[model samples]
Target: MRSWGKSVDTMSSSSRSSQKENVSASRFGPKLCGYCNEFLSNLDLNFDQLNICGWVHSMDYHDIHKSARSGCQLCIVLRHDNTDPEDEHWHKAALGAYYKGRASIMMFLKSTSTTCYSAMYGQLSETISYPGTSRRQRVLDELDSIGAYHDLNYTPPKSTESQTAWELCDAWIKNCIKNHSRCKILHSASWYPTRLLYIGHFPTGYLDRDLSSFNVQLHLTQDKPPKGGYMTLSHSWGFIAFEMLKLTSETYEYRIKNGFSYIELPKTFQDAVRLSRFLRSDYIWIDSLCIIQGSEDDWIHESKAMVDVYRHSKCNIAATAAQGPTEGCFYPRDPTIVSPLEISLRLGGEEENPIPKKYLIVSDHSWHRSIEEAPLNKRAWVFQERILAPRQIHCAKDQLFWECNQTTACETFPFIFESHIEYSKGAAPLALNITSLDLTLSEMRKLRFCETRHDPFPGNFISYPQESSYSTYSNISRFDRTLAHLEGATIDEKIERLRRNIFLDWNNIISRYSSLELTYKTDRLVAIFGVASRVQEALKDMDIYVAGLWRSQLPWMLLWQIRISDTPPSYDCGPSWSWASFNRDVYFYAIPQPHDRVLINVDEAHDGHTVAKQGAASSHRISYLKLRCLLYKIEPDIAANSGKQSRTRFTTPTNPRLGFRPKSLHTDCTETDDYWHQAYIILVIGQHEENRLWGLLVRLCEEEPDCYRRTGMCWIDTEAEPNITEHVRGATDKDKA
Candidate 1:
């Protein structure tokens, strides 16, 4: 076969036709073409529908787009998976030969075909699809049938820039409280933020001045929880300064004597207070307003309590679309844009058959467009808040969205919005229960042993009292009872199952947390510390959170690969051995089979000598990791790096035929991107099933003679691989090249 781009770079239109041939291949039955259809059905090529699939890795992004635009079905599917369905040109791109219909079309086919059920993995997980053949016309006709049911159906109201929208938002919160009786609240009353801004006044700013505005302040003199529910505001403090309005040493006493004037606050703050008071909440917690902005001691204590502050609240009011304070929470929008496309189709899967079935094909990117990709959701701090909070009301550009621990829905498709987070290869589907995020590492290892699963098929999306998935995840003690009530026959099995589940949840958390951007590099671990502390408490020391990883999942945890294009942190976040050491997206790919051989031992973690800086999480900094592991010297391929090194290449000292080459290699960026001559591999784990050796690439730490700095990771597979742990243990210093 010719190289992939050979045809694209040179071949003319007429010559490119290799006869529109059809053949039965790869179990998806008859195929349309040799490339796309064939590859889609190949099990070996399947990598759990992750971001970097075999399809994405095999073809260049530009090349794939070219093929997709030129009418390649396979390329179309690949491009579709990578992009937001909201792209108008995407519809055009999917049109003609490349078009596979919108996500709703896929939803109809998958829901009807052999391919769905994760609709709603507690409403978000894999969106499986049938690998079989079907024409576009047939898919469209089927969707129309569902559209015909519109008259009898109760779709979510189309959003509007009206006061009614605010009422609907309130209804969503009320529904959660009334319906989800078992949902969790992570913060203990003792850990509540020391202060909360009163939201008694209207958003527009109010003062019944004659009645004494000074009485507005409720200065707490005792350790008593407030009587009324308090909501938390999640927003971006824009660059525009509002120093006079914020709480500080100078303003604290003044604010205590006199509550805030809503009119003087930023637009975002004004809207947040408005929503809070409207919801009957007595107080609202905003970081800058509630926490003393300039006081180091106060900021440290308050910052550490972030997780509890947000999780403790009745709800989080997110100004998702607001890039800055001036861009208030309420965004004006056209109601028609978010409304579903109602249509009627034939009863059966025939083209133009005359029996009617009504349907409402909603925007495919409903929740995603409104919330996930929202500007505020991208903040590093929001990562923890999003997961920890029991429920949230997101104020977005297109519409209002509701996200609880179990479901994510928007005004556009107010049912379970069918969307998927690009799950990493080894991470577990996000936990259905907020308190269930595990602090263990075994999930990463055990995932390879368990059967790969797809959730059971679900029935039609109907209008009603929505599906209830509430769980009573009150605390770690509650989890113990939950464990006792589990399906496993043996207590040990139940515990193990819980362990693995939480571990999987941890994987998802870390992978996602790493992808976010932080204003302060030091806040990397600080921002997520509450999650760590809670999970640690829940696990009751099932696994220790050392730096950015768990103690139990070491070797395997260390195997996590930095996402391609993930840049290095400008300052030290943690040890080179930990993913927290860098500021970038990272993921673990479960390619090699299971393993039990651990070739390294981590010593007692050393603490950083420096004082925990302001805005840093207390008691969670590790200076460096001291590991006692077998090391092997490897020589660089000089020919590969004759110029400035883009990526350092390595090979074993042995002959080419017998040498080891890593399956994947990622080099860290530095002040000077140069090759390290004194390169070595720290043997971490040995896997027998895949005959692979997983290790870390390190170089002698120039600053410290005996220490080593992790430069990258290595996964080597050789046909004649030996017992890695045994081989490394028997070798000596002479093995160095």
Candidate 2:
């Protein structure tokens, strides 16, 4: 067989599946049966309408689900578009569509079968680049290739543990190390973490080594920074009835000297050790083993430096596919599923390009499956681990993926979505474009294309944006674009934007980080403290971290509002003045009016955060926060207030006594409008040009002398009566925390 593969220029996104490769796929490509050929003939018609595909007669919902487990290529592709929770719906939809006999229905087909996809060329040709427009266009172009095609690969590897998988992984690392200078780390001995687990040298590869001889030991690195490079592990501890393996205060001394056997470690850790050794790294950091378990002081101290452990390491291994440690980092996958299916088309062409032919399909939701929708990415701590790590190898359910600060490449796509430019050896240095305007690190990260902003105030109640990204097509995300434009979503791209706003970026991070789940409520601030430290470092210490709010971004940061979630807040969190006080997500949704100035003065700001149980996490209750600001008694339109939370209009502009009619006011508590009826408006900002005011709705703190607790965020329309702004300033300033 003769083969020539060229790296294709592109972009795009999907769900996943696997299947046995069709014999002779390496030559003329898999021969599509007559049913698929006829089905392809009616490409425009939906699957349900394509009754010509007699294969549907054998199609069963249980078969699809069964095939999903058995590594059926087509079924896995369907799963690429779904999370586990949503899989049954797609399966049911396929069956229901079969019965309906509609055009909208062989369920959605792709390139792995008949239509040929070009992404695999990258892996084949050893090409790596940033995202651009070409890939998506190619994917969009190949949309019609949904047929019963055979695997492009000639043979299947034994499992993800095969030499083939490791070869692919090695290629990614080789390119990252040799080609990507940015991803390379220059570590001094000082960079080592306080503790590290030393997986004793394996002279033989893990697969070849005798299990009885393999040893593991705790290497306390505080006294001596190891000379060799190290790797880090990101895995789920998972819930269990009994205690899992760990280094405790009691075991600390014994673990350091005696070191347990390889069998003592969990399956995930063992897999990590194998990978680390395969990568030629002897030392690896695992949280539970490195940090003293059941010891709060040690955990807190080590957790504080968690950022460096990941950031300074040579690489981080993410067991992204696994739910718990028991699942391990590897799985036996059908090779055909990872390898795109192939079929040569007979459609007539002018020799340069083909005609009206549709063939080739893709799992557009691979990102959702391999990482975003994966179990590990959901953890709050993983966010920072992902962002801070210089590079990472994701052990996905079906395949492996590489992610670094520079780019992301999966086994399926095997390349990045970069603009395609023909290259030859010794070509002139490639010119990289740098934006002339000096953007802050945060500002630089926020410059994304096709991002949508939700209404700041929807109806009367504010609706918070969830973790979901805005999608243009149900299967395609806004991030799904061409490589030339870098429109495709990178794993960390969205979070990267949050790094830009300096102060505003922190708000974005809080909104994002706060939405994640935490096993320990007290770790709310602890889990994200590393990210905070990074943001602070970027700020060059321009802003002081007063609990969650920045001292400089005050008033704005203090305006963090609770999301309308059924999940209740933990009173154990920081002072009510900070967003960290809430267990559910809180958003800095209220934007200060244009040219708006803070009318409130921070008379006294002190961070008296004591640890929740007994330690010093950032979210501890505040020592003191006194804001001296004028308060004006305001009233809402009874009718508008009664109806579906409508905007309170300033109908009585003639009477200043009616006060500043709040354009929008949503209190944290829904139990009563009584607080709204007796609200005092404190000016957080006054926008003169816009004729609007943004501030907090507050009520007097009965016990405190001239103090108040924030009730809700208030936006007032001064257009009706501009003089109303003066009345707010005329009111007496009261201390508030």
- List lDDT for all candidates, in order: 0.53, 0.54
lDDT of 2: 0.54
> Against the true structure, whose lDDT is highest?
2
Candidate 2 lDDT over 223-337, as tens digits, reads 7668777899998878871467888899888888888688877888888888777767779998888888888789777877887888788888999988888889989876666
lDDT by residue (tens digit), candidate 1, 542-621: 56777666666666677777754446543357777767777788876432233345667666555351225434446554
Model 1: CA > 4 A from native: 1-161, 181-191, 201-225, 241-244, 347-353, 415-486, 563-571, 590-594, 607-622, 637-659, 670-674, 718-737
| TM-score, per-candidate, Cα-based | 0.67, 0.70
